[model samples]
Target: MVNCKNCGTNITSKFCPDCGQPAALKRIDAHYITHEIEHVLHFERGIFYTIKELITAPGQNVKNYISDNRSRLVKPIIFIIVTSLLYSLVAHFFHTEEKYIKSVDARTIENQFVITSKIFQWLQNHYGYANIIMGLFIAFWAKLFFRKYNYNFFEILILLCFIMGMSMLMYGFFAIIEGMTHTNLLMYATALNFLY
Candidate 1:
């Protein structure tokens, strides 16, 4: 047993002199390493369920999350972190190279890409003003249709994230499906929506 010099507490382990400061472990044991890996795996499983619930029922999931039993759900920031990383990864891989787009259909896709990219660029450049714009849009829509709920624009922003997160997840799923089916379902639908 070693007495912690700072706190004057006696501990058998090397960790605390007396105050329980972690003492370096002597054994770099395989069992300890395996236990740590299993713990991480188990923690990640809970995160997966949280994401699943959030995407499946955005409004309800968020409402419940912010409710009394809050810790049961993953934090909103964590959700955003995970979704943002996945979205960036998917965009990097799935998006076609700009130079390769030459066909009529490719041109159409390129145009849609240009429009969406410009809007995102504008939003990035003016986030504060853009938030106000988006906030007002949300507030107006909410007031028009959801008067009973009594949510404000800021609340709408949270809801929008939930929706967008779900959309990104769905987009990833559908992209995979499109790849497997060898059909341009996502592209055709996107074109129709823009054309209409």
Candidate 2:
């Protein structure tokens, strides 16, 4: 057996048993850089499959994850982070909240609308934190409603994280559409998302 280049330990496999590093670290050359970038951008597994499973069979996905098939699905915390980042990026690039505010009739605002706008702005600015807090509430509510499911708090939290992460993307786009069209599309989206 040869010593692992990474940790100088006897390793018979391609990876170091102790640290999980490759036994033979590749040189930092053009080929290695190209391969690494390609693997991250093209071959890496995430997002698409996560969203697909969340959409197609959320309950099954949750069950599978809790029942020892965890490796097949993305981790709930990572999914939440990724989806939150996506939501922030889309909201910033498109200015959906600003558009929505502008689309509102001035007459409708009258006198008290300034405070309402301020509240909306605060909510938008702290959306990531708000989402996490909301997920906690959602998990509690689901646990209460689905008592027969017999899931504990943390387990239900994981399920809600995956469920909310998937639906958040839809809410982002629906807001964009509502802003662009100056329509009441958000009302319908809100109803749909509530049931989601």
Candidate 3:
């Protein structure tokens, strides 16, 4: 048996049980750089499959995720982040953000808003602390109500995050549709989010 390069652990199987590294290591070369770049771009199986699985059959994905079939699906937090980034990018580059900012009446606010960071302004001058606190409440209630399921607050929080992420993706898709049609479909999007 060879020692694991990662942690010097003894290996009996193809992978080290302790560090989970493979028994063999490839030599560094131009191929290594090419492989690294490919990994970064996920030329192999990656985010596209995750997004497709989530979008097409969220119920099965969530069920599988909760049941520990996570290899195929992206992490809930990662899904949230990617969708949020996509929405932000679309808003930024497509002048949607400018439209929203211009629409907001600065005169209506009586010196309450402080210009601190670009992100703050981009989020419509809202820190969204209320939403976080409310999410905690929802998690707590979910844990209490679903006692038979035996999910802890953290687990419920993850589940809620997954649901929210899915909704965010839907909103992003709706925004794109609205943008293409040059119509105010986001009014419907807002209602959909509220209902979701």
TM-score of each: 0.49, 0.67, 0.66
Candidate 1 wrongly placed segments (more than 4 Å): 1-46, 55-59, 96-117, 120-148, 187-196
> Which pairs of residues clash in candidate 2, taking residues 3 or more apart in a chain or in different chains?
none
Q: Give Cα distance to truth, residue 51, candidate 2, Å.
A: 1.1
* Of 1 and 3, the candidate ranking higher by lDDT: 3
Candidate 3 lDDT at 156 equals 77
Q: Count clashes in each candidate, considering only residues at least 3 apart in sequence or on different chains.
A: 5, 0, 0
lDDT of 1 by residue, 26-118 (tens): 576999898765543245434566666765675677776544456656554444445545644553365521211222333557575776666
Ranking of models by TM-score: 2, 3, 1
Among these predictions, the greatest TM-score belongs to 2
Runs with alpha carbons beyond 4 Å of true place in candidate 3: 11-17, 23-45, 98-108, 113-138, 144-149, 194-196
Every model's Cα RMSD, please? 8.9, 5.3, 4.9
Q: Higher lDDT: candidate 1 or 2?
A: 2
Q: Model 2: per-residue lDDT, tens digit, 14-114? A: 88898788876778999989976554334224567778777788788788898767766667877776676777677677666564333333357686577
On the 0 to 100 scale, the lDDT of residue 193 in model 1 is 29
Specify the highest-lDDT model's number.
Answer: 2
Model 2: residues with Cα > 4 Å off, grouped in runs: 1-9, 24-45, 98-122, 140-148
What residue pairs are clashing in model 1? 3-17, 4-17, 4-18, 15-23, 16-20
lDDT of 2: 0.72
